[model samples]
Target chain A: MGISAVKYLLVFVVSVLLQVLFCNNILIARVIAPFIYILFIVLLPFDTPRSLLLFLSLALGLTIDVFTNTPGVHASACLIIGFLRPVILNLITSRETLESVAAPRVKTMGFHWFVTYTIFMVVIHHFFLFFIEAFTFEGFLLTLLRIVLSSVLSIALILLSQYLIFRK
Target chain B: MKNLFKLIYRYHVVFLFVLLETLSLSMVVTFNNYQRAAFFDSGNFLSGTLFEKFSSFAQIFEFKQVNIKMAEENAVLRSALQEMLLKSNHGTYHSSDSIYLPRIARDSSQKAVYRFTTARVINNSVNQQHNFITINKGRHDGIKPDMGVISNGQVVGLVTNVSENFSTVISLLNSKWKISAKIKRNDYFGSLSWDGKDYRRVQLNEMPYHVPVQNGDTVVTTGYSSSFPEGIIIGTISDFSIGSGSNFYKIEVMLAADFKNLVIVGLIENKQLNEIKHLESLNKYGN
Candidate 1:
């Protein structure tokens, strides 16, 4: 474990703190929820094994749920995305293109493609996450509206963070 | 078995990711439905103490703003106090046993002494049909359900529920609010309820169209019940109109309290509330 190991740990701790404090505090109408914390999973080292990716995603979701008090909504969504990421990445990018890349970045995937990919994954995750969190159809329409609204918000935040911090 | 273990060990990253993702999703679902983890909230004495340490530092920055606002408010209140004293000197008043104004520096002849204990409003919601105020005081602080709550000497609402360290109040302007009140000057009394249109106004019902009511008349609680201690200020008559083909006059009241900037409050314990409630319910249930 060298400087790289320490840097990764620092990044993980800081991301969690920021997610809890800043992102969650901006609950627009108490509906739109930002899961930009998923950016951690989304940026995992390329060639990271599928099962490890799933496990880390699960850990990330559970940590958030523990803090915020919304239980399994995030954990389950992260699993499905983790399992499908390989397929989705393959569908969007060729084997040769991903081979040269270490992680998902605007530079590797190209800006428009990266944004589109993020919007899709974040929206899918939020839809299942919110639907399960609501846990009822009494206000089914309201739940859908919340999902759509939060997805847009979370995607915007993720895109902005990526644009600001990571050129690639 | 040895080969399988080796293969899983070799691909541990994939396994780790899957396990972590599954764990995270479960937390979200359980939290939403069961709220199991909420029991472990920072309310634990240990974490609470830690947060309290942080709050002391935070309060340093907040105190200046609060004190400055209070000082400016004190100046405005002084003028209002003078006006009230002048009005009372005109000798137009009613004597009630419930409202005990102990501090009458101007007139040493003050009657019943109403004591006030201030509490902070930590959370409030005006969007609900039955709006509620979460005050930071609770059973530890002598707050109980059915007690009267007031701000600036006027009725705000009644205490409805109490947690160990928190209590919820049903504000008067809520649509679900219905409190018995009467005209302070006369025997005419009615129920006050809000129609949810304005935060400043409420509707008075059941007053017969012939009560000789007029605009700017003072309205106070009849105190016919134990929820309030008789004659707590409710509001003043703002406007009145006769409903189409109805036997009652639809009346609007401008509440006597400025509800939005509530900082200090008083929770009144009638001391006899439970006994009164027991008697009233006995009549209905015959138990």
Candidate 2:
């Protein structure tokens, strides 16, 4: 348990640093910027306590917010995802599968399952985040395009990281 | 009490979700409503220090490009100065000796209007609807809210929040910010705003359709506000059109400063801003 705590702590710090320093600066076509820090929330243990999951997600979002100069937009998006993760997981796979797997990953779960799970979570999170950040429906088609492009890029980065680093 | 305990236990997750979401939404509302005086942002100490450290390391890579631009700009300024000197006193400037010319550029009649402090860009974002820039200077460096920030002689943003060693600038690309600007050719002023679509192109509104704007016409600050001085180059007109049934021209201006490569910026401190504001307030109530 202690080792696990230290490992997760390391993940938290590394993701936050990678996000603010690296990912935030990648403005592809002046619209698509990958947000990979959400992978931390996506990769949390399946059996994480609901309250703990919500708290961790909020803390993670707030940390990104503090760095990016958006106060509550990210926090709100992350909180919604944290709340809905269990429901989404149940819809995707059986309760028994969730109980058997220690955590959701490409190695533990099949590639198809991991891809499906990540797409759903990332799409939902980006939708809420970008819309809230915009705060208005003006030029909404452009905003939707931004959300879609950013989500695809974010999911690609998350998957790439999983393959390169988390393959044990 | 047993039944009540069971109800509370069963609905605990829902209660928690509502509580947390409320907190988050309230924060969003508060932050959006109040762009100035931010506390939980990069301008705060911990993130500010982290970004500053990171930028110090990152700025090394841009040294070559920055040096080239600086040299070119210096050459242009030197020629402009020479022309001004020659025009002011035709025969008196016989020799190009350093001692004959006046040391201070401002004569006694021209009081110093603006003072500039150089600051480094530690953090910046342009893709977002509400883009902000963080600089490694703050209240200690005489930077206050509403001070205009320029880079490479082009308008960049306005300072909105300041800490002891860091400040956040509301980038010109932010949809919420608007600055008064005018065409350099005809001097017809309009309100310039970002449309949250593109960082390079900003919308110049309230320009009457009869103004006869053309592509590549230079736009500059109007000097109507204390934030910016008159004739600071904003951008040149890139595209323009008249919307159906609208009396005004929808102008698209390509910004002069490249926000993507922002490294160093100058913060302009207006010496008479307080006096101007105070007098304006007096006229409000007819006192």
Best by lDDT: 2
* DockQ scores of all models, one per candidate: 0.27, 0.77
Badly placed stretches (over 4 Å) of model 1 are: A29-33, A163-168, B1-39, B42-65, B68-287
Instruction: Give the Å error, residue B269, model 2.
Output: 1.1
User: On residues A18-134, what C-alpha lDDT tens digit does candidate 1 reach at each position?
Assistant: 675456545456345566777776666668767766766666766654444345655677777777778778888789877887778876667888887887688777777765655
| Best-fitting candidate, scored by TM-score | 2
Error of 1 at B116 (Å): 10
lDDT for each residue of candidate 1 in B128-154, tens digit (9 for 90 to 100) = 223455566777887777788987558
Interface RMSD of each: 7.0, 1.2
lDDT of 2 by residue, B21-87 (tens): 8998898887774374366768999999999999888878988987887787568647856765676
Please, what is the TM-score per model? 0.51, 0.92
Clashing residue pairs in all predictions, respectively, total 45, 0
Candidate 2: TM-score of chain A is 0.97
TM-score of chain A of each: 0.88, 0.97
Number of backbone clashes in candidate 2: 0
